[model samples]
Target: MAGDTPRAQPPPPDPDPGGHHPHLLFWRWRRNPLRRRTDRLHAWIALGLLLAVPAVAAAAMLAVGDTAYRHYRSAAEHEARTRDHRAAVLVHDAPRHPEPGSDEAKKARYPVEVRFPGPGGETRTGKTDVEPGLPADSTVLVWVDSAGEITDPPLTAEQIRSRTMGWAILAFLGVAVMGLAAHGITGLVLQRRNLAGWEAAWAVTAPRWCRLP
Candidate 1:
């Protein structure tokens, strides 16, 4: 018997029969007596809300986006009401060909002197931007308020859609940021709670686990 080779011993089983192994990854969900009610609550939160994080964030984004777009549309409509489309005559001749160095050459629009009717039907003159290449006295449709002050042109359908989409994206990003913040805070809270739980558990179990038989 002494000359026989020793048989290979099986690995020791985990001391906590309810837990999977020495490493306690899911010890809270295991059927262990040491697991507290708070442990179950935290476990359920991690499990039940794992998919909900993105879903809630997306829903929040949609709600905020709808509100933002409605406000934007209302403002745009108000602007349209305050502004009128009317023709203004150019007082100075437009360049036949703007120099490449000019902003007009790149943008194809130019600020030039123009005269138009005021609210009182009197001629009013001011420098306003226009599309390039129109000669002097050329009548160009522009947006003007009742005060005869130049204003931004009304939003085209494309412009409205673009603005709506831009605002929606911004809203979506904002919600996503808030969602991420919430997830981070929840993680920190869970981490602290889990650390405290481990400390409490170790206080009771460490002596047994570490004692030499």
Candidate 2:
């Protein structure tokens, strides 16, 4: 009678005893206190985000550069408004006998120095011969100075124009690129373990026909 009674089939085994679900992976990675390939991928992404430091540095330089240019321009404008008179004097007179070991006497002789007054009783002196061998008239940038003092420095050279924005934009772009690259690298790293495990599991569970191909 026992043999005649049909034997109940054993319950089928689970498809994934290893628990290969995405949610499970996430939970295990978070709470199981074990580092996995997925975790390493995430760490790589974090490192990429850390690259933003270079971008921030670029941004700071942009800000400082703009501020410096503004100050220089202001100084130049003030100087022009107050200039009383400018003269072209050839540098000729050297003390009959240069003071021995005197710092003042050793000062460089500019064939011509442009002397100008500054705001708040300051005196500013700049070399007139900016381009050696060029005519004096071509080298001087004389502005109308009615206030009698140099209020500003010269406009920053044209080379510095738009550089601030360029740097800031470059920083933003760099951060973006770094972030994307890190994310991709992390994904690739994790995929190695995930794919290998998947293949092994498939081999054990699938029919013989699906084994290799």
Candidate 3:
């Protein structure tokens, strides 16, 4: 026995199909004769979850944005209608103003002044820093003869840009979630393949040793 080269042993028989080795169900399913039908089902389940979560998030953001924009625009138009009798005109367009705190600053805009029409068609003027940049020819809802010019709080262009950035972040998160889901599915498939190969190798080696006299 010492001089003889040990014959390589044949592997042990595979575990009974009903035996409870961890991941045994996975092996049975993967190596089942009807692999195509079972594989399709597994593929659909993983792919469906991978797609559905991100799609739902993106749809939610779109719906919220649309509803809010519509409400804001409608309110702006309504305010314009109420000032119709006060001889107000909307500024059609304004030139882009120079950035504040720039070297080329001309006379800085003081509080915007407003004047309204009074009972005898008299006009009064008032001043405040609030001004929605109006074109030189634009007049907004105002009682020009009764009350002084009124300044409306200006909504900065920067604020609008910030709001847009927020929406983009939500969109990016949705995309990231999709990427994670895909990565997880790939990892699961790889682990199962490795496990099956290990089991196959063991099936061959274990039986050979067990059968030794």
TM-scores of the candidates are 0.63, 0.32, 0.34
Cα lDDT tens digits, model 1, 1-213, are: 433333333222224534456577577678876565666676677665556766776777677667767877887788888899778999988765547558757677778989988888888887778766778999987789867888887667677777777777776677667756765677567657666766666667656655655
lDDT minimum window of 10 residues, candidate 2: 88-97
lDDT per model vs. reference: 0.71, 0.49, 0.50
Clashing pairs in 1: none
Q: Model 2: residues >4 Å from true position, as ranges? A: 1-129, 132-161, 202-213
Q: Rank the candidates by TM-score, best first.
A: 1, 3, 2
Per-residue lDDT over 1-213 for candidate 3, one digit per residue giving the tens place of the 0 to 100 score: 433334343323334434477765454355555344334455566566668756766775666555545555565455454333354433234333467545443444434444456555675554433233455445645432113334343333454445655665576576667666765776467456655765676667656656646
Candidates 1 and 2, the one with greater lDDT:
1
Alpha-carbon deviation at 57 in model 3, angstroms: 2.0
Q: By TM-score, who's the top model here?
A: 1
What clash count goes with each model? 0, 16, 32
